[model samples]
Target: MKALVIDDSRVMRKIVGGILVDAGFEVVEAENGQDALDRMAEHDDIGLCCIDWNMPIMTGFEFVVEVRKHAEWRDVTLMMVTTEGEQDQIVRALAAGAHEYVIKPFTPEVILDKLQFLGLVEIEETV
Candidate 1:
């Protein structure tokens, strides 16, 4: 599956994008929410989005709300990958439309675990 990694920080994008690519996803990246929306318009194969909460032009929360409005994007799963770790923020994101939330400074395993919850991947047992 294709995944969009949206973040204002180039380094964060690289980190998240690398994780998804390692998980077998074709990765496309955008610096912010608006850029991501534009990329999505061009790529119909984007099944997942890893979004950062704070962005210029449009925030990740706004992106979630806006994407949920489009019937064409109904099957796309949104996951917020941000430094905002407050419980209320987590609840708000999920209530808005995010399928999963991962706080920043996360290990790759944390992200893969969330992907499993979203049914995007299955991590094999390691002995």
Candidate 2:
């Protein structure tokens, strides 16, 4: 599956991208929300998007709102990978149509498990 990782931090982006890649997903990188939107416009194969809450040019919340407004992108699973741990932030993200949330300082296992919960990750045989 194609997954988009949106974050301003190059390190964080690489980390998340690696996790998704290890999970058997084809990864796409976006520096921020606007960049993510541009990618979405060009790629209809994007099945999942992992966006950071705080970003320049456009915030994750704003991106979520914009994506939710469009019918064509409605089937794409949206996930917020952010440092915002407030209950309000969680509620707001869910209300804005995010499929899942993962706070920062997260491990690859946590992200993998969450993706499994969302049914975005396929079960693979162990070697």
Candidate 3:
């Protein structure tokens, strides 16, 4: 499946994208929420989005709200991957339509685990 990695930091985008790529997803990138929206519009097959909370042009919360307003995006899973670890912010994102949340400085394992929980990925049993 395709995944969109959205963050203001180029390095963060690369890190998230690399993780998704390793997990067998075709990854697309966006520098911020507006760019993400544009990319999503262009790619109808995107199944997942990893969004950062704060961004220029549009914030991740705004992005989630905008996406949830459209029935076409209903099947797309939204995951917030950001430095905002406060409980209220987490609650807000979930209420706004994020399916999962991951704080920054997370390992690839954490991301993969969340994706698996969301059913966006199948976990391979390790020997």
Candidate 1's C-alpha runs over 4 A off are: none
Steric overlap count per candidate: 0, 0, 0
Write down the lDDT of every candidate, Cα atoms only.
Answer: 0.94, 0.93, 0.94
What TM-score would every model get versus the actual structure? Answer: 0.97, 0.95, 0.97
Clashing pairs in 2: none
Better TM-score candidate (2, 3): 3
- Candidate 1 pairs with clashing backbones: none
Model 2: per-residue Cα lDDT over 2-104, one tens digit each: 9999999999999999999988889999999999999999889999999999999999999999999999999999999999999999999999999999998
1-127 per-residue lDDT for model 1 (tens digits): 9999999999999999999999999999998889988999999999999999999999999999989999999999999999999999999999998989999889999999899877899767767
Q: 36, model 1: CA deviation in Å?
A: 0.9
**Once superposed on the true structure, which residue ranges of model 2 sit more than 4 Å away at CA?**
123-127
Q: Write down the RMSD of all candidates, one decimal each.
A: 0.9, 2.0, 1.0
Cα displacement (angstroms), candidate 3, residue 67, comes to 0.2
Error of 2 at 49 (Å): 0.4
